[model samples]
Target: MPHRSELYEDIPSVCWPIVYSPDYNITFMGLEKLHPFDAGKWGKVINFLKEEKLIGDDLIVQAREATDEDLLVVHTRRYLNKLKAGKLAVDRGWAINVGGGFHHCSSDKGGGFCAYADITLAIKFLFERVPGVSKATIIDLDAHQGNGHERDFMDDQKVYIMDVYNRYIYPGDGFAKRAIKRKVELEWGTEDTEYLQKVHTHVEGALNELKPDIIVYNAGTDILDGDPLGGLAISPQGIVKRDEVVFKAARSRRIPILMVTSGGYQKRTARIIADSILNLHNLGLIDKELVASEAENSKVEKMIRDSVTDLTNLSL
Candidate 1:
C-alpha cells in the first residue's frame, strides 16, 4: 500500500476541495509587514470568500502542514533538514490550496520568501500515492518564474511545466529557464489582453501537447496591476477570467487539477483571489452538486468492490 498521509485523507462529501488553514498566515509580532508581500492575505482570502457566501469553514478542506517525510518525497534530506532547522505541504480532483505556491524555493535552497517547495511536493505525492496519476502538468501564471519546481523537475519527462512570468523579475535564473517546456516570458507592464491571450494560447497548447493525469496550477494573483513585484498590468477582472479559462479547460477534459495561491503582495490581492474563486463557483466550474454526485458514485463503487472481495474470501 502507498504510504498514508493526512494531506490525502478522503474529504467529506459536503466539503469542497479548496484546502486552507488559519496557520497558513504568517504573523510574527507584525514583523511580516516588513516584507512587501501581504503575509496575512491567505487569511483575508478565506475571510472574503466567507463573507461572499461562496464557502464556509466547515465546507472547506483543512490543509495539514507537510511533514518531513512528505517533504522528502520531492526535496533532499539536507534541504528538508534545512527547513526543519528553519520551518515547514494538497488534494486531487480540482482542489485548491489557499496557501503555498512557494515557487522560488527548491530542493537544496530557498528564496523569494518561500521556505519549502510545496508545489513540487504536492505533485510528487500525487504521482506516488494516487493510482493512474503518472503524469502532471504545471501551469504557473505567477508574475515571477516558478524557478523552484522547474529546477526540481528538470529532467523528469513525466512533469511538463508551462510558466508565464515577467522576464525581468527577481531570481532570473537562466538555468531554470531551460526547464520550462512552454515558456511565455512577458515584458514589464504587459497588459491584460496580451497577457490573457498568451495564457489562453499556451494553456491550451500545453494540454493538447500532452494530457497529464493532473494539473498543478500555480495561480498567483501578483499579476494584478500595481503589484509591487509582479511587474504586470493585468486587471482584477482579467485575473478572474484567467482562472475561469484554466478551470474550464481542466473540467472539460475531466482532468484532476490542484491549485496553489502563490505570490500576491498587494492588500487588494486577497479580494481579487476571493472574487475569482466566487466567479469559478458561480460559473459551475466548481459545482457543489457535481462533487456531491461524484462522492455518491464513489461510495457505490466501493460498496460493490467490497461485496466482490467478501464473496471471493468466503469461497477461498
Candidate 2:
C-alpha cells in the first residue's frame, strides 16, 4: 500500500484551482527585502487578487508545509515536484501553486534559492498515482535554466521538457541540458516580440510532437524588463501575454496544466503575477469548470438536507 500524505487532501469544490498559503512567504527579519528575490511576494499576489474581487478567501485552497514523510516521497527517486499542487491539478483540470516552482533545486542539491524539486516531484507523483497520466510535459519559461529538473529527468523518455531561459545566467549545467527535449536559449535583453513569437511556435511544436497527460508550466516573471538577474527585456504586458499563450495551448488541447510562480526578483513581481491570472480568467481559460461543479454539488447537498428535514417533521 502507498503511504497517505496530508498534502494530497481533497479540496472543497467551491475553491478555485489556485493554491497558496501565508506560510509560503518567508521573511527572516526583513532580510527578504535585502534579498534579490522577494520572499513575501506570494501573499502580495493573493492580496492583489482579493482587491480585484477575482477570488475570495474561502475560494482559495490553502497549502500546508510538507512533513518529513512527504519529503521522503520526493526523495525516494531522483528529483521531485510539488505533490500537493500536482494532485490539485489532476482533479481540477488546471491548478496554480503561487509559491512553488523550485526549478533550481534537485533531490540532493539546492541552488538559486530553490530548496525543493517541486516540478520533478509533481510529475513523478502523477505518473505513479493518477490513472491515464503516464506522460508529463514541463514548459519551463523561467529566466534561468531549470537545471535541477533537467538533471532529475535526464533519462526519462516519458517526460518531455521544453526550457526557454537566458543562456548567460546561473547554473549552466551542461549535464542537465541533455534532458531538455526542446531547448530555446535566449540572449541578454531579449524583448517580447521575438520572445512571444518563439514561445508560440515552440509550444505548438512541443505539444504537436508528443501530447502529454499533464503540462507543468513554470511561469516565472523574472523575465520582466528590469529584473536584475533575469537580464530579459519583457514588459509586464508581455509576461501576461506569455502566460495566456501557454494556457490557451493547454486548454485548447484539453490537457490539464499546473502552473507555478518560479522566479521574480523585483518588488512589483507579485502584481504582474496577479495580472496574468486575471488575464487568464478574462480569456475564459480557467475557473468555469469549478463554478459549474460547485453549483451541481450544491444542488445535490440541498436536496439531501431537505429530505432529512422532511423525515424529522413527519416523525414529530
Candidate 3:
C-alpha cells in the first residue's frame, strides 16, 4: 500500500509584516521601517517560491489596521483605553512598541514588548473570515518571553498557546500562569538538542490534547548563535533544524499551519530563518506537482521520506 498524501491543501498564507504599517520606532536606532526585517525576507521567500512556480498568489501585503472591537477579543477594555491615550500603569514598563503582544500589558495598563494590538486581531479576523479554521494554536518560539500572549489567553480556553522562551528573562511572566498549555523556559546556555526535545514534546501534546484546527507558528529567530538578545547559542543550521522539526511535527498531524515570522533582530539571522520556514511552503508546492506524476511518484516519495529521516535523526 502507498502512503497517504497528508499535506495541507493549496492555501495562501496570510501575513501582515508587509501590508500593516506601524508608526512606532523599534528599540534599535537604525531599524526605522514599518515591519522592518520581516517584510523584506517575506518578499524574498515569496518571490523565490513564485518564480519557481511553487506558489501561485504573488500578493505581498499585510491587512489594513484592525478595529478596536477586533482587538477586544483578547485585550481588556481598560487596557485598550489607556494605550490609545498613552497612559501607563506604574508597574507596567511601557506600552507594546509595535503591534499586539499585550500579554504583559495589565488590565489597567500596558507593559512588556507590545504597543497596538495585532496578534489577537489577526486571530479574530482569520477565525471569522477563513472558512474551516475555527480555532488557532499559537506556537510562540521567540527568544524573549511572549508575555503578552501568555497573559491575554490566560482564561480563554479557545486558543491554545505553547510558548518557548528564556526562563527568568525580561518580561518574566510568560510561565507563571495557567493559560499556556506548554511553557519551555530555557536557561542561559540551553543546548540545541534540549530545546528541540522540549519543542517535540510540546507540539505532540498540543496535537493530542488541544487538537487545534489551524496552527499559527511564530517563527522567531532571535535564538540564533550570536543574537544580542538571546543567550542560547544556536547555529544557523541549528535554527533551521528546529524549524524543520516544527514543520515535520505539524505535517505528521496533517495540520494547516499559518506561519508568522514572529521576531528576529539580526538581518542575516532573520533571512535564513524566514527561508527555512518558507522553504517548507515551497516544498509543499513541489509535492503537489508530484501528485500528477505517477511515473516519478516513487522517486519523490523516497526523496521526501529520506529527507524526513535525516532531519529527524539530527541533533538540534
Candidate 4:
C-alpha cells in the first residue's frame, strides 16, 4: 500500500495550489538579519499577494511541516533521527510550495541554510503515494548549483535533473554536476536577454528529451541583478517571464508541476516573487476558476456515462 500523508490531503476546490505557513519564517531575536538571505521574505511574499488581492488566507493551501516518516521517504534514517526538523500544496495539475527549496541539503548532510532535502522528499512522496508518478524532472534555476538533490538522485535514472546556475558560485561540486543531464553554466553579470534565451531553449530541450511524470521547478530569485550571492543579472521581468516559460512548457504537455521559492537574498525579492505569481495567474496558467471548471466538466462526463450505462442495462 502507498503511504498516506497529511501533506497530500485533498484540499477544497476553491483553494489554489500555492502553499505557505507562518512557521516558514525563522525568527531568533533578529539573528536572521545576520544572514544575507531574507529569512522573513516568505511572509512578505504572502503579504504582497494579499495586498494585491490576488489571494486570501482561506483561498490558499496551508503548508504542513514534513514529519520524520515523510523525511525518511527520501532521506536516510540516520539523517531523520539526527536533527528531527522540518516541510507542498498542489493537486494533480500544478502546485507551488512558497517556503521550500532546500536544494543544498542531502540525506546525511545540510548546508547553505538548508536542513532537509524537501525537493527530494516531495518527489519521493509523490512516487510512493500517488499512482502513475514514477518519473520526475528537477529544473533547478537557482543562482547556485542544487548539489543536495543532485547528490541524492545521482544514481537514480527515474529522476532527470537540469540545472542552470552561475558556475563561480558556492558548492562547486564536480560529483553533483555529474547528475545534471542538461547543465547551463553562466558567467557573472549575465543579463536578462541571454539568461532568458538559455532558460527557454534548455527548458524546452530538457522536456523534449524526456517527458517525466512531473516537473519540480526550483524557482530562485537569487539570479536577480545586484544579488550578492547569485552573481547573475536577470531582471525582474525576466524572472516572471522565465516562470511563464517553464509553466507553459509543463502545461502544454499536460504535466503536473510543483514550484518552490528557493534562494532570493534581497528584501525586494519578496515583491518580485509575488509579482511573478500574479503574472502566471494573469496568463491563465494558475487560475482557480479554470481548475474548478475542469472539475465540473469531469463530474458532468461521469454522470452522463452513468446515465448511458443505466439505459443500456434497462434495455437488456
Summarize candidate 1's per-residue lDDT along 209-299 as a digit string, tens digits: 9998678898999999999998999999999999999998888876766777888889999999889889989898886566545546676
Query: Clashing residue pairs in candidate 4, if any?
Result: 66-87
Instruction: Give one digit per residue, the lDDT tens place, for model 2 in 1-316.
Output: 4457555555565678677777677778777688898888989999999999989899887665555455565564343443222222222447777878889877777688776677776776666555556788999999999998898888989999999999998989999999999999999999999999999999999999999877889999999999999999999999999999999998787676778888999999999999999999988888846435433655532332122111100000
Q: State which candidate has the highest TM-score.
A: 4
Query: By TM-score, how accurate is candidate 4?
Result: 0.90
Candidate 4 local Cα displacement, residue 234, angstroms: 1.0
Kindly list the per-residue Cα lDDT of model 4 for residues 1-316, writing each as its tens digit.
Answer: 6554445455676777677777778888999899897888888989999999989999877665555665666678877677755543333356666778889988789888788777777677666655556788999999999999999999999999999999998999999999999999999999999999999999999999999977889999999999999999998999999999999998787666778888999989999999999999999888766555544656642332122111100000
Q: What is the TM-score of each candidate against the true structure?
A: 0.89, 0.87, 0.64, 0.90
1 or 3, greater by lDDT: 1
TM-score of candidate 1 versus the correct structure, residues matched by position: 0.89
User: Candidate 3's residue-wise lDDT over 79-166, tens digit each?
Assistant: 6676552211100000011222333443334554456434554454445444454667878787876666556666767788888887
Residue pairs whose backbone atoms clash in candidate 1: 66-89
Candidate 3: global Cα-lDDT? Answer: 0.50
Instruction: Please identify which of the two predictions, 2 or 3, would achieve the higher lDDT against the true structure.
Output: 2
